[model samples]
Target chain A: MLKNFADKPLVIGVTALNAIDSPGPGVAVIRALRDGFGDNIRVIGLSYESLEPGVYLHDLVDKTYQIPYPSAGAHALVDRLQYIHGIEHLDVIIPNFDAELYNFIKVSAQLRIMGIHTFLPTHEQLDARDKMNLSKFGEKYKLHVPEAITIYKADELRKAADELDYPLVVKGKYYEAFVCQTLEQAHKAFYQLSAKWGTPIIVQKFMKGTEINIAALGDGEGDCISIIPMRKLYITDKGKAWAGITIEDADLLDLARQFTKATNWRGGFELEIMRDADGKLFIMEVNPRFPAWIYLTAGAGQNQPEALVKLAMGEKVEAFSEYQVGKMFIRYAWDHITDVSEFQQLSAFGEL
Target chain B: MKLKKNIATSENGFIFNPSTGDSFSSNGIAAEILGLMKLGRSADDIKQHILNTYDVEPSQLDRDWEDWSMQLKDANLTEL
Candidate 1:
């Protein structure tokens, strides 16, 4: 019978790119795993690129290694596994970024075959990551999501403008947002965005009010162990929260629960939401991986990253978290600059 | 500036003002500071008291107090 990992098992966190970026979910997961689990966990942070200056890999992990981006997909990842296994037998692999999550899912079955446990869900979890898919799921779950219409060609956006309200949002099928002030602006935005980002451009009704995020980790058994709901007090150029505060919104928590339950989701996830003028909440997007602001919640008593690592090790953890309200999270400029462009680009192609 | 007399706070972290009905919650420190504000203390007085009582630095206390006071003002928590 499969058993929970023995104590102090080797845990490796795999990332596809830069490691120095702060205010990222990966950084929080690393810290929480080390802080919460302590000597019981041996962390190894692996990336596809060199370590950023001023970052001490040894400080965060027992070891650090780099692997080439999986150009050949499965084969490249398998080679990385071989390399990792050679150094120290890894018991679990945690994919931190969206790109790495995609790669991890592609090779998930193979990893399980090798006695390596990965908390990654199947392709069904991919639906939650795609903005369009989550919007559809929202309807079935009775949760309100942004009114968005997807179009293929730039001219098709004219129909979106005619059908939707003014000040519509012009976004790619995956990620990337541009505001359209008029129908003509929508068309221009569609073309420019499509030319730069390719396919399924979406126009969503603009929601004016507070932006909020709900993050959680689940056991794949209809039980969520941790939930952190935050309201965006300050948003950056990339729409990342530069400053945010923990909030107690029971309705928002219910929405998150309904959405996750509808998907039968397991593992760590984040939901981007906004409250309209009437106080009605609508989901903006769903991220399958942890958000860059996970640590803000960590300090507030919901250590989701730690929960994920623990769950992956087959440990029995609490089924729910009672989060503290009134805590604040502030993201520095450097953290915002480090990965915004690249992450946005990858999001455009649905590659992340 | 005159201080507003209406003050509201709940043990569960809920705060609502009968004057504006604007609601909010605060962390331990923010809650403490706002609680003091309910006693009708001036901003400078509150700052001085917090600095003297807490191990926090003067600048940090001033900045946090200023931000908190501004938020209260935005919510119309201050006097007319």
Candidate 2:
């Protein structure tokens, strides 16, 4: 049973409409929403660029509106959203991009005042899971995390690498990572990442293991609503999961619960895990939003986005107890044929 | 000749190892062997059943059984 306002379809706005090789979760989340609400929900696509594939996928997205980039600051973002809300009367706005989440969180109260609700992590929760602060978070929660050292300068990388040893991982502040086996490669990675994503490069100890991912939803009260662990069956060169299978892992579920309990994680989150040969699970990273492959959770019987919507609406929701063990999701790319006129309409008018 | 106690198999050759959370699909011969293993059939009993049911030389069956057993072991579907 889905809820609608005054017998009208629930208008929900979603961002990160890019569904490419390295995709965002917007499309998948929208699919789950459609599955849950069917004709009862109206989707408004929020895009930073006009060319995002979701903008042209008219069948899935009812309307498209161009939003300002996160660099425009929270005030500009709220101003844009206020304009969109005036027309669309959005009931919920799910900001899916990591880069834009800070602004969304900042303007969440303002959005609420305009009658738009969002389920997102708090500022403290978001900061605790930041790439640079993961080690400290892990230590505070008493969870296993690989040793990592943050270096602001390339010269500092040598000492960090020496501490972590060779064949370590060099990571940028926000994104990009390289597994460097030698100091030379580490320096190259440090310079390259710093050039693109800025300094304070993170050099981490390399843990040899099978990588597993857990997509989870929390109720903002230290309660885990759903958790689905997946093992990547295939990976792209960019380290994105091309194909994955849902798995049953008690330890992985326990880790998700522990993280939720410790952080009181509000919205959807993903835990990048490394299970070593000795069966030790380490917290590799914590993404503060639903992952691109979030549809797999619905396939496995959780329907996390739907649950998240209910949570966002302040409805009483129950925790999901179990899910199918062997469900799999294989992602593929398809060419969407669309007239350039639709692109021009969105670009010129800022709405389509 | 023994599958793990918690290993679940379907007639269509889908096998699930709950302990490791790994799933696999097998060909007809492998599925047959897995079914026999689940039924607690001994190695000789499984070999005899395969020889009686399928058209294969005993030596070829022996080699294939060894390979299949190794695969099952590697997948952690069979108890040592």
Q: Compare the candidates by lDDT and give the number of the best one.
A: 2
Q: Clash totals for all models, in order?
A: 2, 0
TM-score of each: 0.74, 0.92
**What's model 1's lDDT at A119?**
84
Q: Write the per-residue lDDT of candidate 2 for residues A73-124, one digit (tens) a residue.
A: 9999999899998898898998898889999999999888888989999999
Docking outcome class, model 2: acceptable
**Candidate 1 local lDDT, residue A303:** 79
List, residue by residue over B1-80, the lDDT tens digit for candidate 2.
Answer: 58888898988889987545578888877777778888898999989998999899999999988898788888877777
| Model 1 C-alpha lDDT per residue in residues B1-80, reported as the tens digit of each score | 33366556755556755422246776777677666667777778878887788899987776866777677777766775
DockQ top scorer: 2
Cα deviation of A137, candidate 1, in Å: 1.4
Name the TM-score of candidate 1.
0.74
